[model samples]
Target chain A: MARKALIENDALIDRLSATFREVGYEGASLALLSEATGLKKASLYHRFPGGKEQMGLEVLQEAGRWLGNHVLKPLAGEGTPRERIAAMTSELDSFYQGGRQACLLNLLSSPIGEESPFKATIRQMFEAFVEALASVIAEAGCTPAVARDRAEHGVALIQGSLVLARGLGTTKPFRKTLDVLADELLADLEARA
Target chain B: MARKALIENDALIDRLSATFREVGYEGASLALLSEATGLKKASLYHRFPGGKEQMGLEVLQEAGRWLGNHVLKPLAGEGTPRERIAAMTSELDSFYQGGRQACLLNLLSSPIGEESPFKATIRQMFEAFVEALASVIAEAGCTPAVARDRAEHGVALIQGSLVLARGLGTTKPFRKTLDVLADELLADLEARA
Candidate 1:
């Protein structure tokens, strides 16, 4: 029974995340969340008695944690900077392609505007991702400042690529952009060497 | 009377464009559009009988054309490549800040999942912007392939910065990102010179 409840909870979060991606925070109403999650309003309320804001916070946190562990943690592990950067970018491309979805950060960040309760969470998530990448860059023996700047550029490129890919309605540009960025960063590192 | 009608039409388009930026294409309903423009539903229908889709298409087209002329066109004009590039970046920053809004291209692109009707228009606008930039790059004496690649990067950066800014709920980062990109390009051009 405990196992079944965990499975149900995972399913609920997944559905909620999808709804948030499809509709902005302000736009995702309780009725729509209920419909998307296949739960009755009572069940949804039971799960998130704190209501939509609670549910949104949970979804954002889950996405941030998942992405950091699966998509980013690998990049921070064993390899030369070039290999790690390549691996990281390839993972990002696959993640986007596999899901046929834009990044959750890109989607959620917009609705969280100035002073929204979710603002700090979203900012922290972004900073965490950047810091993760910077750690990997630093491991490659670059100065801390160079590593941080490169990491910032890499994060920006990934986030930006999604917007461009979505705008062009093709994933080709997105993948290509990431590849170019990876190559450029690797070249810069090699130059330092 | 004709001049007044034209003014009203322009004002309505401006309002619709603002709504689309804030809420996105799918989120902007006719009721919201009417409310945004302070137009009665009857007046909206009179101006846009084809309804929301027609208004969206017109707004998208007009924005594309206006951006091309005011932003990209200047980049393709006579000047040293570095000067032209800086001018272009400044123009883009000003244009975005002028409206205090994210680019319509970035907003509309988000909802264009497979085979969207707006796909062609969006692609065309992007291609035009890149092509204009490419011409300038090539004039700076780079190979056609190199120019095209750099131009693609430039467009990707601009579009991506807009998304980042919108997601972060601050224009400062967006504008800063663009400035960083412009500086990078300028540095590259000077090295080549």
Candidate 2:
């Protein structure tokens, strides 16, 4: 019974996250959230005592955890730097569903207050992502500074491609960027070879 | 008096656009919009008879006009491809206010319906932007296809950097990307030289 409850909770979060992604924070009204999750307002309140803000915070937390597991952990796993990045890109393709979805981070960030706890959560998530990618690039024999630079650039490319994909109504830009990411991040190592 | 009214109208749109940039579409409630424009709700409705949707449409149209004049027109101006791009980059730097501003295109696109009139407006704006950049790149010795690809990539870089800047509360990524943009877009020309 405990295991079933945990699974149900996970499904609920996924539904809530999907609604947030589709309509953004301001658009995700109580009516819509309840509709999406098939839960009454009172039940949702029971689950997330602080309401939508708490739900958003939990969604961001889950996203960070997802990235850590799917992206950062693999970057630290056993493989060449290029291989690790390539592997990670495939997972990103899955995470983004091949660029059909806009990023929740980009969508949700604009509505929150400057002092909102979400800001720190998001910044830390990007920082950790960059750090993990930097370490992998460093393993490719670039200096720490260069690796850091490449990592930041890689993150920007990924984020930017999603924006383009949405604006232009095509996934070509995102898919093409991913194809080149491994090489772009490890150009120094490639040049040596 | 007529000129004064026109100027005030422009300023009003600017205020509305800034509000959209800050909080996005769903977040830009009637109360908030009234606050941002310093107009009563009825006055806003008087100006934008279609209400928030109309205001959002006008904001997008104004943005496209601004981009055409500031970015595309300059790209087609009589200067070397590299010089044109540099000047345009400077304009962009000011337009984005040194990356302290989040992009309205990225922020405003999320909440509107998929079939929203705003989608076509946004897509056309980006397409025009990419086409202008591609022309400049082709003038810098890249083939037509290559120019288009580079242009798309360049747009992604700029858009992505803004996302990073907003999330990290730092303009370094945006500034760094702009600094390298001319060279990155004109590498083929430089290589020939």
* DockQ of predictions, in order shown: 0.41, 0.58
Candidate 2 regions with alpha-carbon error over 4 angstroms:
A1-7, A111-113, A191-193, B1-7, B111-113, B191-193
Tens digits of per-residue lDDT for model 1, B121-171 = 887888788788888777766678887777777777776656555554556
Interface RMSD of 2: 2.5
- Winning candidate number (lDDT): 2
How far out, in Å, is residue B27 in model 1? 3.6
Model 1 clashing-pair count: 0
**Cα RMSD for candidates in order:** 3.7, 2.4
lDDT per residue as tens, model 2, B1-193 = 3333322788999999989888888788999989888888998987899999999999999999999899999999988898899989999999998888888788767433377668888889989999999998998786899999889899999999889888877888889889988987887485554
Identify the leading candidate in terms of TM-score: 2
